[model samples]
Target: MTAQGAFEVKLEPQQDTDAPAGRMVIRKKYRGDLVGVGIGQMISKRTAGGTAAYSAVEEFSGSVAGKQGSFTLIHSGFMSADRQTLDIYVLPGSGTDELVSISGTLEIIQKEGTHSYIFHYQL
Candidate 1:
């Protein structure tokens, strides 16, 4: 199934300008088919060759498609001069309540200053 929603996120930098790893605290509030809040942290840094990479883990709490439960999301992202790749997935064995055993992935879309999510999953 798929759940659609809009979310607002706040990212706070957790390190100085020259920190080897740029750490950030991520907080999100979502509305629509998926009503919940997510808390996560991200660590990213630029390589000497000018490439960059980051990874994050977020826990989402509340309801998904009317199912009362929670799950964790994992994020992996990479950037280079020619391309960028980002992958977000539901962490296995991290589901609770009705969402137990939930598995799948999530996509984030941004348009005109608005952020939305497309979550495709199976229980």
Candidate 2:
């Protein structure tokens, strides 16, 4: 199944933790076909060639297409000089309630300051 929605995100800078050069608390509000609030933490580092990498683990609780459940999302991303790679997926066995066994990937689209998502998954 597939779902499409818009999400609002808030990033709060955290104190210099032992993690990396950058740390933040991530908060998200998802709407449309999927509705939920997600909270997580992110650590990012600057790499060579003006590139960067970041990783985060977020837990989202809500209803997807009318089925209620919660799941975890793991993110891995890297930026190159001319391109980027992002891997955002639902962690295996992380689903709960009606979403148990859910596996999928999420793609984010940002344009003009608004953020949207395409979720492809199997339940």
Candidate 3:
């Protein structure tokens, strides 16, 4: 089955370094077909030439399409001088409870200053 949802997230700075890179914690509250919260940590940096990169790991505790459980999502993204891209996916064997067999990819979309998620998955 496919589960779909939308979420709003907040990013809070957690650590900083003189190397021009730092880390932050992320919190998310989701709605739609999936309901719950997500928490994660992210590390980000910018290159001397103005490119940015980030990696993060997030655990989502919620119910998807009515199945209650939790899973971890890994993210790797970068914004070059002229382009940007992101990849988010469920970590293998990271599911628990009702989501024990979950596997999927999540697409984050931003338009007109709004954000949403497209979660494509299976159990």
List model 1 lDDT by residue over 1-123, tens digit each. 899989999999886677678999999999988899999999988989999999999999999988989999999999999999989999999999999989999999989999999999998
Q: Candidate 3 has what TM-score?
A: 0.92
TM-scores for candidates 1 onward, in order:
0.91, 0.94, 0.92
Residues 1-123, model 3: lDDT tens digits: 566667888999975656567799999999987799999999998878989999999999989888899999999999987899999999999999999999999999888877788889989
lDDT of each: 0.93, 0.94, 0.90
Q: Report each candidate's C-alpha RMSD, comma-separated, in the order given.
A: 1.8, 1.3, 1.4
Model 2 lDDT per residue over 7-88, tens place: 9999999999566579889999999988999999998889656899999999999988988999999999999789899999
lDDT of 3: 0.90
